[model samples]
Target: MKRQQLALFIGLSLSALSATTLSTTALASQASDPQTVFSQAYQSYLAAVKADENVQQTAKLAYTSGKAVYGKSDDNTANLAINYAKAIKGYGDELNEQRFALYNEAHTILAANHGKQSIETIDALLGQANYTTSAYKAANFLEQVIDIAKTQNKPKFVADMKLEAASLLAKKFSSKKYREAKNYLEEADEYYQENLPENSLERIKADFLMASFAEGRKKYNQAIERLNRIVNVFDSNLNFDHSAELSAHSKLIGLYEKQGKSEEATKHCLAIAKMVPWKESQEQTPLYRVNPDYPLNKAKQGRSGSVAMEFEVDTAGFVKNVSILNSDGGVSFEKSAIKAVEQWRYAPKFEKGQPVSATSQVRLDFKINR
Candidate 1:
């Protein structure tokens, strides 16, 4: 077997079928069973992922032939539907409707075959939750999975479900859903703290969600504490930059700023500015951005305007020498834009691997209901 194909077979628990010598192209011609053809095409689809090749046709073949062989309620058909849905998602955003249809089909088949609360059904629902754009639908699916998981001896699965539920529920941001999200976060955090490594990604994700929930509820101190712990874990355990670390620092910064702790916020702003790549190496690029608040008077008039500003980023990444190039609104818009830009930080340009001050321009738009 090809090395990548063998790895995929192990992952899919299809080692027995992996021994077959038929290529996907030859499978239909050589084997009378649609099952054999579907299985080979499925393997081909997996191989395509590793090869960074598109095999949507093969994926479709897997689905159609698998359904013919195993029927709709068969576990094999359900699995094929779910995996192909995920694969189709990778093709692009254009297939979103089709992918959702596949997930819905898989969930229905799995529920019929294995009962509503079975692992297969739960997994299919989770897939739908992951792909759905609507927060309400995602939360509904995750809530179902979490409820079902509670009835089984599946602490880890239940915890995972709760964590997902917490993330989506918080997005709803209503009082009831917010409290529900908080409860779910607490449960997920407890399980992760007890069962996973302190520095594990799963634990960190739970902590991050907790931090977000805290921030949303105006509990700044609590949010800061949670984010700081995450920062410490990333620093001491990982000793490297990750997107999660950036996110923690970003949250810490806004929380500190909201609490009137400019010094602390600046510290994180600078820290974040240094973590990512700078502009083209020839231009300064923003790392810490502050959105301009709508001018109260203009907002009252239901007005909207934009101001373009040219600014100098100092060697330390602080904005300076800011000048409003032009504005479509009035002086209020220009002043607000400049105020926000003054607090912004950037990745200063580097020449010969040394930091250099550089000029950058940005247009800040102030609008209500935008």
Candidate 2:
């Protein structure tokens, strides 16, 4: 097992002891047949998921499986479904120990029997990938799917697999398996190049994923390059929507701003607001704001000390209220600190890249000794 897998396994086994409580709350107040009720709930969940593109399809699928089991009226199957959902929802008190472990074992057996080349095996593996909290399992199973997609020479399937794998990578970027993720993404990129033509949606998607990985690594300039390519490609095609172009523009502006390239940043910011009506809030306007900074204050002299200050900025950029969120036996010195911060300079807050008056929270640390 890899380092990430080891971390995931250890994370799964802990010293926490607790009892399982099944939620019959929805069932207890039942006013209809269990099968009908479950079917309706399952359908509602699917619609709720489909209506929102951001909804994780995996959650909905799990619900559908539960509904099927419940509709059969088998006590054990119904119990398994409820427990699986509880584990998924992080409902610690409602977890079913036997069912949860059994679900895992069932998935493993299914995958082992069908082999990775079978679509049935892929579906079972993907289901397990979706329901678990283990990042390692998610990444591992997704990799397996990608492997099958590649060997199968299915363009659309390959694209879908890569995108899903990239998304998981973005979530687990901080883990030790990032290198493996990069390798998979590179493989995906090659597939896109061979299978997806210029200006194809899949190519654009591939570009976006590579750019996101660059951003995660703090390679701002590289990220900018990938995003620029995406924009240029779409622009030349004249078939893509302005919204996609605007997204790339926003990303570039943010990258430039983070790089402290004020001139480049301003240029992109203006372009974004003009190109997209919703981005006007990013413009610079006069707003009372304070940039908080702190220095190590381990050693100092005198009766002065440092403390945390919380203040609210008004819509007009004025410091309206100041209070200590935390104090180290030194509330007396806070008044002076707040007074000084009130006069601080700030660029105006913008909503959607357009200049807009807004309330922003700021934190200040006064180090009396430093």
Candidate 3:
């Protein structure tokens, strides 16, 4: 998982617990020293475990202790319940039915304290989605999150959730689900355009997702357009090593091959080949390279592609004037091709033993089998 996903997961878990609490006089008195309450609950839970008491009984004691701090309507109660549930889940390698039961109990408590459609409830849903055994169930939970985000006027959040939901739906592509996934991607693109900066990573990601969605729908031209937009941004920004850029390039190559644009595809393949380190001078070689992730829709359908590009290696060994010479695929391939070439480094050509700029080309191929 990416760092962003992990952060979002943690945030959602905390938000779910925090937002569900309802204030009451009893809660206020207990909340005066929440730390003490949490500590007592932990100690009791540890003691119960040490004594080898009934696991469910010990879990209940922990839950009760947490509730004493802020009543049943407190975030601390949810947090304690979640912790105990995790402990139970990790207690043994065998399937622990009690763990899910406890998780459901915590979720029910949160929903009862808050409203079913509340952000708190959505958070719990996200947690369930993360831990659930069923992909369909997870997709449904993400859809709910998207709906809640829409109602709250959180366009960025809506886009984020929609992207996640679309990805899930795309993974399980059927005639119906593919259409649904495309719709989600389209909606996410709208939100991204309205709420995010043109060069924002989130917007780039949206474009990547849109390209995939377009390809899945056989809207090759639209997919190309979306990918081209991503490449243009990377070219202007010069942050060519982004994973999205690589994906764009790879998809473009595949799309081109599908269209029988062999010449264009060959160019992209050459452009990728140029990315190999020119080790004539160690200092001139690329320090790092980021490969694009294969398009999920394409992977599912057993598709492949390639891209080619040209650029100038400056005296400083930095790539410059990057351009797609040809691409068999659409904008997706071109974007990634240009992006990678733009980051290429090489020993500057020598004329009379003096460093000088030189022109070069490379190709990249995207393939997968499953």
Candidate 4:
């Protein structure tokens, strides 16, 4: 199996275990020593995790004690701020200004203490990347890390940074951005071939990004070739990421559909049905949606309404038996919703490693252009 790699994202989460921790108890007794208090706080946090209890209290204690012990402007203090931020972020306060400030604090301290080019600044820059929603900005942070890794003669780190930089830049399409990202990816590919194993997930992820780049540029043939390679790899190496394989099939469907190749698209549609569905997050959700059309009569009358329908996605991943449970609109709206849903597709549920039909409920809304 390919070694698990860090998540390739702007907010590449720093490991919370970076700081030392061990047996410690009674925070009140360790109040005199901020370091001891910090350790105690982490110990309490571990118990909370094991017991599946809320971690806010212990997390706050760790933050408070960490501040006291890491008052100096140095790498240790920078890392402390990052860990504290990660703790609260786990509670779902991802967009809070305070969290971003904590990340910025780490970046500032790291730059001041170790200089901009030091390897130590990498985490802080990556931490700051989480504070921004812009893919371009996140790629910029990776670019800085690229320079730092080069300065420190860390080829592996540089390659890792480039891989992520390419992924982020692939989020949008622009001729200039594509060219720049391609360069980063090409070099990273070279490093991966020489260093990482043949089946490295990171290398596969890099290929995925390159495929996305091709898709963005409307280079459909190139994108299909790359995605097919990923699918083939997973076929031989069952340990590979199945989601990426499903995603490859999904991408192939879109690419083929754009070229009016229904047979090719259905091949993927059937492929998805044979595989288990991904539901842990929307990131892995496949889109074969066929939107309901607005009725012309409703549009001319400036009427808007919704239709609630229940349907089954058969083992073949085709929508069937779309029954309207309710509707605020007229029969026209109901008919449109049914027609559209019948064309929709899904990754049918699997049981005992076998494809199974599944039912779904949906509310399709239709609004006239205002």
Candidate 5:
């Protein structure tokens, strides 16, 4: 058999039929000989396909069997139709002509039986979006899903769908579409801000997209800010190996390079390189420095102080083992100093031609800029 047909057969064969609630008479008949009753319809579907019968006829039989076992408005029937359509399209032959019609028919049936705003219908729409050939059409389907979500008062779902649409729009090669993509991203951001926490995965995803938009528009500073926010969020809430943090780091390096800030780019590269063993025949140095923000309260009180911190720069160029050696400032200044220093990325130190951990001390002065 063809590859697509073989795949479809494997998928269908592995799927277990689910029992549906039925009328009393039907239930009694099903209980009497459940397997035989269901198999009769299913086997007929299989026989029709094996005999190279009409594609529609075979799909109809599959749907009939699925409904018999899983109810008219069940996901099973929709899946059967979708699978059949995908298989037909994969054939890339005369049968492919009817694939889209079959898909639309399936979605129409689902929406008719299960209300258009129902979760079942929304799921079917999402499935259709994935299966459709045109990006614009897929985005339209997602927009419809979002509209339904709004009617259902699901802000999170609306945000998720908006992000999906934005992501799709961002993939287009035309720069003209970037504006539209940005609009969608902004809408997604609004919803996310209202519904998700600062460190939530969904919000991070929005930040990533917004950063991309900024980069596309040549707003390097804005892009850098967004990328840094993503990194900070991931570093604070997720493991080191989280994909978003890695992506943010990579993007930051690229953006810094574009801005001709080779030193900044190199710092991030060294940080990532710490993941592997490397040899450097030079002493470590500060590549980037961040000044601590003087607390407003301290400034109003006319307070000026200094904080000294000792930390270790690991092979990956990340600061760790931060200790407060001394602090003339109050707790507010000390906290700000630690937060800024922790975000610092350093150049790797070399000992005997190999990168190794090194300890260092630094003092930060916090004073109100009168």
Candidate 6:
């Protein structure tokens, strides 16, 4: 019995030792070393950040310094240094140095791994662009990046990147660089046709930008077509609740007027007129505040009375042929009233879908508040 008990104790001891050894080895294999953990985490972070350039770069630094002594194996340390520094900079963190170094490394690595002709260099170039301060500098960077990406047949990235480039180009259009900006926008359109959904907002936006650019060049027809798509094709309901819709309507109205479509212009003008609320009043002649352009004697106090005038409103909504049916008193005041009346615009009466000359009477009253 004594021998058997001793043998059992020895067996238990050996089993415990073996179990402890296996546990240590397994832990070591998994993430036993802090260095190994850091290395793995760094690589994971790099891959995770492929699309987000703005990710907190401290992720790399944390991984570099997070390793415990046991994890600080030479192989793990070297690999950690390589990959982390490859995505980041080894030198003390100057924002420019860190940015430029990462870009340089990204370009070099992409060229080596993805082939010299790959557009992956665009990724690096874009990173460099993120650090640029000047609009022109940023545009220049994005242009090159987009060119390379498109050359390497990356349709989606090229398309996405072109949005920023096009905006910059539009801002710089007044300068000699407008053509280059236009070319960048054209390239963006090509990408949108391939990658974006038909009738997508992005595609619509691209069309809108091009249209505005055309309009800036006084290409009215092209601008009208683009504006029409936003109203007719994209937003068929003509919802005017938002500022964008209002702006679109305004553009369409201007285009109509420019193209001599007076009828259409009148329709829009009436729509705008309807938005302004009218106050019901019992006064025969409502008090009219003179527009600053009206030549009124500053020293003279306003005299109150009504002057009834007959006017002809033309097809273009212009008031013409003003004649006073009844005058209150002064000739100077009457003349001033008639002159301002001639320049007044009216909502022309419509007959058979055309604005016709209509006779109307307006009573003008001048009142000044003390």
Instruction: Quote the lDDT for 268 in model 3.
Output: 43
Ranking by lDDT: 1, 4, 5, 3, 6, 2
In model 5, what lDDT does residue 184 have?
Answer: 75
- Give the best candidate by lDDT: 1
Q: Write the per-residue lDDT of candidate 1 for residues 1-370, one digit (tens) a residue.
A: 2111111111211112123232322223245566567667766776775575775666677778877866767666776676677556354455776787888898998788778887657767866775676767877887788888888887987887787777756654445467677788899899999999887667777777777777777999988998998888977866544777888888887787677776677666656666665656454546556788888999989999999889888766678999988889799998888888897765555566566778888888776775
Compared with the true structure, model 4 gives a TM-score of: 0.75
Across 1-370, the per-residue lDDT of candidate 5 in tens digits comes to 1111111231211011112221111111243244346545555555665675665556566555555665555555565666566445345434544555555766787788777776656645655565566767767786787788788676776777777767766764225456656787899899888877887767777888788888878999999998888877766874534555656777887688577675677656565454434444444445455667888899889999999999998775667888999999689988999898876666667556566778888888987667
Q: After superposition, how far is residue 283 of candidate 6 from its true place, in Å?
A: 21
Alpha-carbon runs more than 4 Å astray in model 4 = 1-36, 46-57, 90-96, 133-140, 169-183, 190-198, 277-287, 309-315, 320-326, 348-362, 368-370
In model 5, the clashing pairs are 274-316
The candidate with the higher TM-score, 1 or 5, is 1
1-370 per-residue lDDT for model 3 (tens digits): 1111000112431211133321211222233455456445555555665565665456666576656754665555665566566545344324344555555666777678776677766656655655555666666777777877778876677777777667656655444467767787788778778777788766776777777767877988888888878867876876456555555655666676567664554444433334333445333333233466555665566767787767787664557898777666456656755665564444455555455677777677877754
Flag the better candidate by lDDT, 1 or 4: 1
Query: Mind giving the per-residue lDDT tens digits that candidate 4 earns over 1-80?
Result: 12111111124322221233333223333445666676677667657645646655665575567667656565545665
The 0-to-1 C-alpha lDDT of every candidate, in the order given, reads 0.71, 0.53, 0.60, 0.69, 0.66, 0.54
The stretch of ten residues in a row with the least summed lDDT in candidate 3 is: 1-10
| Of 1 and 6, the candidate ranking higher by TM-score | 1
Give candidate 3 misplaced runs (Cα > 4 Å): 1-9, 12-74, 80-106, 130-136, 172-176, 270-370
| Per-residue lDDT of 81 in model 4 | 66
Number of the top TM-score candidate: 1
Error in Å for residue 85 of model 6 = 24
* Weakest 10 consecutive residues of candidate 5 by summed lDDT: 10-19
TM-scores for the candidates: 0.77, 0.54, 0.50, 0.75, 0.53, 0.42
Candidate 6 residue 156 C-alpha distance from true site, Å:
3.2
